[model samples]
Target: MTPSPGRSYPILISVILVGLVALALGTQPIKPIMSNWPAALNIAAPDVLALPTAAPPAAISGAALITGVAQAQGEGETALEVYMAQSDVQEDVGEGQVRFTRRDVAGGALELLVLRLDEHTNIRVINADGATPGSDERGDTTWTDGQRHLRTVQEMTTAPYALRENSELLGAIAFGFHGEPRTANEGTVVIDGQVLRSNPGRATLCITHERRAEIGRFSSEDLARCAQAIGGGPVLLWDTLIANPDVATAEGEFLPFNPLGEDFVQLDWRKKIYNGRYPKTAAGIGLLESGESFLVLATSYDMTGIDLARQLRDMGCYAALGGDDDTSTQTVWRGQLTRARDVRPVPAAIGVYVRTQ
Candidate 1:
């Protein structure tokens, strides 16, 4: 509404007085007006600003998981350049976990990639067999080779390129990628003749197994001052255990056909195939001497193993576990229950094999 000139004149005079007062107070709040008001009025520009966007989540995935520090390379590309750009992949590959699987597609197959973050993390991938034939790892150190094969599975799922017969260059590229990428063309790629690719980024490709052993948490030991505890116990018969940073969040916690529960209760797949306790996280055995229990602890690949061992020792722990491998020598439970009649000789041993008669 337009004001009457009589009232508008007073308003203008009041504004002028206020502006002068502000200037006298040395508080020049009209700097924008003084600097650009004339130019703005001449141009007739609207006084508005665009809003900003929210930051994306720290984690991003195209197809597979990127654990620790990782980068992806497409087919026929050299990942050495990408790997050297930032060595985060080294820590990630060396420290973190990833999982790869074949996914069936309409025309052929695709590959699924999953990555995990943190030590006790888990990532689950649905329809994880679309890009290549289902894989079951075999052999001792050959598991490393299996990890390399996962890269081809990833390429088949994500790349539009194909590998040349006996291509060393392609193999090198796959080995260089921390979270292996896969592809099709490497046939029998489809499983159950179905195409998979349900969730791209949502798929979990890594698992972190963190185990703890407390002195007061378990049974007692008879040795002079030695106890034992173990995670991933009752090791599989033919299947050896490796520190896998792949296979969703419950990688080491699960087995084929015995997936983890929604709440991540690792299924006792070993029970179905073996005769002992399935994979375990931590087990503690206390050394009882003079009615005082000395704690013994063990865990899987957790950096806190040494710290825990030290703390237990400080608390008079007889024996403890510490190492970077899943198969460390510190994790064990020694006693009559362990079926070892001569338990004194096997006091602080980890990775002990027991038969549940």
Candidate 2:
């Protein structure tokens, strides 16, 4: 149908605007607009169940107490067996008959102990005349016989080769003769590879060039390199406790006369011939399993060789040798003085010095 152009244009424009508004409303949901409203409206609601969450683990305390049960159990299972094994090898006299009372002595580094020996105890002897004399000078003595006079000079000294006792006196006894001009004991005495005196003896104490002390009946050639020596006596204890009956030998290795023996028939004969008799006091040295050296003195009365050997064994000494005894038994321990009733002057003495830590 034919119409006016202005009127038709206005009618078409209004129709297009109405169609655009309807299309926008049809595409979007009414629920999206209701979601922004208050809960009271209750258009679309969230679920009732809550979401899961993770929590941290428990912590340890900084000041927690420790129970040593584990350590105690480990020790109980292992230590006792080891201790028992050691006790078997080492001499364990429940409580030794000789009570060793320890005290700190003066001058030397070694600790001193006063030993009181019972009837069952023993000791060793060390002679100083066999070694070089110390440098300290003592005094002189003179004897007037009718018209002729003999003068003798006495010196207070230590063992020259064994210098350990020079500055610090550890001598416990006076051994052997001093002024008599006689060939040194009948045995091989060597100092630093040089032979001082050579003869023959049943037993000898050999101090090696390295200062290790050994005791036995050694051949002259065997001890040619020794640094020092002490020659005397029947070896009371050798590798083991030597039975008195086993001491006799065809070669005279063991002296037939033992002053310590029960048979006192030869007491006067020994004193006159050997210049030795039963001692009222005695001294000796020993070596322990731990390699430590020990010095023992028996002052109350004389100790027999058998008794001394037994005592040394029970005291845990693997090897031991006798020293001088009688009134000549004078011990200068840590500078403290201990002497027997008859304190005689000695020309030389064996000294013990402890190494400083």
Candidate 3:
């Protein structure tokens, strides 16, 4: 459409006057709407696997990992350096009742799910067969010589294996995590107020009838406080600090089949087994703005027991103990696998549920 010259001149003059008025008013230019990332929400990147490093020394085999004992302890390798964000994704998934955070750490990520310990939520220890394994932990603390033998029990499974068998847990979990026992059962396990196995000084997860949770060494004084408990050692976090930074000190061997025919050999596989930013999990309790809360944490990639403790402290945890690491590290949040798929079948788990309010 062509404007007449007389009308165009008036329009130009009006535009000029508006421009001068805008300049005097200090009007700012509109920012461009970016079709791509420059819109600047600057959201944290998604989780990723750690970069490849030299192949770490492999444990002899899967069966070897399941049954081999450590003859001599090896020094832990210096961990790969990383920078975890002070805070990352903290979306409250189940209204304000449950929250999950996946904080970025270097190239990988760590996950934390905090469930409010309010009147609406409840927690319990779920064993695979609804019974604690009827096996006693018998073997040497260390085998100085290989020519000895002590028959022991082997009852290990994946997280999903334990999670699926319990019908009570299927539809009720707000969040759940694999309980301590990994290669072989260590520490203490108490189910339904009955002590299935009792050994003091292992990192223990204790839940009282009141829904209060505790993580620390299993001891006599602590026994009565726990209606349910699961033992995973080296206790990594306590009193809100990195408590046991040296959980890598291998405890002993797990050879149930007695392949070498010696009863057992002492081995510390923590440092070597959970190598270089491999995923790890833990159960803990922390004080938040709401009050003390239950915590189930995992690293998507790149963390050890010590690293996990540091992160938990940063996330407001007062105390915690290690869960199984590597593939044994698994979590379920509101019926979703926090990891991609269930690669392992565990024998036991801690399940949290919402009460029928």
Over 245-308, each residue of candidate 1 has an lDDT whose tens digit, in order, gives: 1223323322222111111122243233222222112222222322222111232222222222
168-267 in candidate 2: lDDT tens per residue? 3333433333233221223334444654443222234555554445554344455564565544444344333332433342122222233112112234
| Steric overlap count per candidate | 51, 9, 16
**Candidate 1 residue runs with Cα over 4 Å from true position:** 1-266, 273-282, 295-357
TM-score of each candidate? 0.15, 0.43, 0.54
Ten contiguous residues minimizing lDDT sum, candidate 2? 64-73
What's the residue-level lDDT of 30 in candidate 1?
Answer: 25
Residue 159, model 1, lDDT: 28
Q: Model 3: runs farther than 4 Å from truth?
A: 1-94, 136-184, 243-267, 289-291
Q: Pick the candidate with the highest TM-score.
A: 3
Ranking by lDDT: 3, 2, 1
Compared with the true structure, the alpha-carbon lDDT of candidate 1 equals 0.21
lDDT of 3: 0.45
